[model samples]
Target: MLSTKRAKSVEVRSKPGRIYTVLTTLGREIAQGIIPAGAVLPPECDLESRLGVGRGVIREAIKTLSGKGLVSVRPRHGTRVLPRRDWSLLDRDVLNWLVGQENPDRELLLAVQEVRSIIEPAAAALAATRATKTDLLRINAALTAMEASDSQATATAADKAFHLAILDATHNPVLQGFRGAIDTILSAVFVVAVDSVDGWFDGNLPNHATIARAIEERDATKARDAMEQVLGYTQTHLSKPKAGTRRRAGRTGAGRTLSQT
Candidate 1:
């Protein structure tokens, strides 16, 4: 008689949050070019030992990375790192890892802002027409939180909330489809920019308030204009060198995961 044994799925089991640790460590190494493209990753057993995690955790991390286009795994060939161009750079975890790097890439951050400028203004215009009272209230509430925030981190969270609220107000699924990608870009852009510069969060409050007010008044043109102004400031801010640094002028360029309301 054939025995019926339930097969268990492999998961992270070495320690609490070991999977995250492995993912972050390896992700950063790849992002920073520590593990250069075309280099094969260390063997699974080696990573397990080095990271002090079990094989299950290591495999899971590698599987996740492979899905992000960071690595290619095959039976005969070992896991090899892929070129940065192949990576899903807009992936949330990958963006977060990039932000966590010792010196985040400025050029990448600029690219994010460019994408935002293209999408956000159009969404804000749609939001002015489509937003309900509840949407307006949410946008207002986010602005309120920004006003009340005592620290840069708190304010940045509220800032992200304000923008996300506007996007939600658009009520266009086609536009909303861009949300996930936008979220990743905004997070990496905001965190790196804010952490590097003091008072980075100060000037943006008025711009956000203007956007919310325009949407509240159902003025699509003004909403779009205000939104552009907000993003424009961000572009200018990112273009300038950080205070106290003479970084190259050519070089360019939030905080949470959210469920749809």
Candidate 2:
């Protein structure tokens, strides 16, 4: 029998390869609640046959799940799915799998926005007070890229970059760590927000410039206000339906062109 240390080492050093496939498929299922908490995973041999992988691969996959707090493995009993709270909620793959659910988790989305409301306003205020010329240049460059983007996809990416640039301007390591959580939700919300409102980016494109200009002027209050407006627009546009359109939570609409801006 392999020692626990040896098993973990093998799982980590080996290319994941087939194990990644199994982990993603099963991990997504677990994240989506298809395999609910407390359910027992299939026996090793059964998983091997079902997933078309060797015993070693099965063991490694189980170990991977264990590390994520998704399952608890035992010597006699089968691996049991742990409670959702026990899972590593911040793990990238776990979050991605959660994103795969047909109905995106609104609560989770709102939670991220709440954190943004708390962190970004302060970060923008600090940036306004402390940003150097080079920092301001990066922020303006991102704004320019956003304006020049040809497609909604490109615009969304540029929009994220603009905010990340502001975060970088703050120059505080502890606050910078908050970015990982924000990044996880930014894309999800951007896609959903654009889809929720007609010409969303067209109406909001100038708000990012508002933030950049305020920071350039070194007006802490204006910078904070501008960032709050940007986030407020995100919340309002995502939460409320378009004037004539009934609420379409997941519909992908034809977004307005950003190239003309």
Candidate 3:
């Protein structure tokens, strides 16, 4: 049973999207470790009283969390927070909850980068072989947006679009299906990287351009290499101390220049 204080901590006022509000509040607590694994949630009645939401809404929110592997609801056992290992880390909501925490999980962020390192280079290679003119245009347009972005928010969106455009160009339905997961993780990474590392967005533009140019020329090898180089810049930015640890460094200069083939 949740303590009275703890239950009150998550209380919600009636509003539109009440279910989503309840879901996010509870999910954020779980993700941020305020509610640790193995802790059983309060009974439905208690939650109903505390959150001021209908029982059905609470059930639905728990059901959705269960689908994300964040909880296990057993007959008579109540709902228990599942171990982090059991979470569907790539699920859009889960990733958002995790990375949106005040102190984002460093290990999880690195795992996102690792996933990108494994997938994006290969996707870029495939796009080089299969991307149509329209696909290339989308990629170039995203790059142009990144170059012109004056705010961190716009730069982050453009950066995500640039990567997503390459993934779409692969023309593999299975790969294309990863769009939601990829978009969420990229947003998380870009948000953190841009805030933490000076010139994270602008410094990586040349690498992104190399990827676009290689795909346009149908050079699979160059595209893959350029994509890897772009990811390397991400790795560097992610590895740096988070913002405010030190004075923001001078604009992170471009990394190893990718020679045009």
Q: Which number leads on lDDT? A: 3
Rank by TM-score (best first):
3, 1, 2
In terms of lDDT, the poorest run of 10 residues in model 1 is 252-261
lDDT of 2 by residue, 1-261 (tens): 569889978756764788898888889888888989999987888888988888888887778989988999987888999998898776666767776354567666666677788899999999999899999999999999877676656776777788888988999997777666566667677545644656566677777788899999999999998888888877766666424533332224555523111
Candidate 2 deviant stretches above 4 angstroms: 1-14, 74-77, 100-103, 241-261
Judged by lDDT against the true structure, how good is candidate 3?
0.80
Largest TM-score belongs to which candidate?
3
Candidate 3 lDDT tens digits, 72-150: 9999888999999999987888888998655667778888888889889999999999999899899999989777665
lDDT of 1 by residue, 59-87 (tens): 88889999999999999899999998899
Better of 1 and 3 by lDDT: 3
Give the deviation of candidate 2 from the true structure as CA RMSD. 6.1
lDDT of 3 at 112: 84
TM-score of each: 0.81, 0.77, 0.85
State each model's CA lDDT, in order. Answer: 0.74, 0.76, 0.80
Colliding pairs, model 2: none
Which candidate, 2 or 3, would have the higher lDDT against the true structure?
A: 3
Instruction: List ranges where model 1 is wrong by over 4 Å.
Output: 1-16, 177-202, 245-261
Please list the residue runs of candidate 3 whose C-alpha ends up more than 4 Å from where it truly belongs after superposition.
Answer: 1-16, 243-261
Please give the range of 10 consecutive residues that has the lowest summed lDDT in model 2. Answer: 242-251
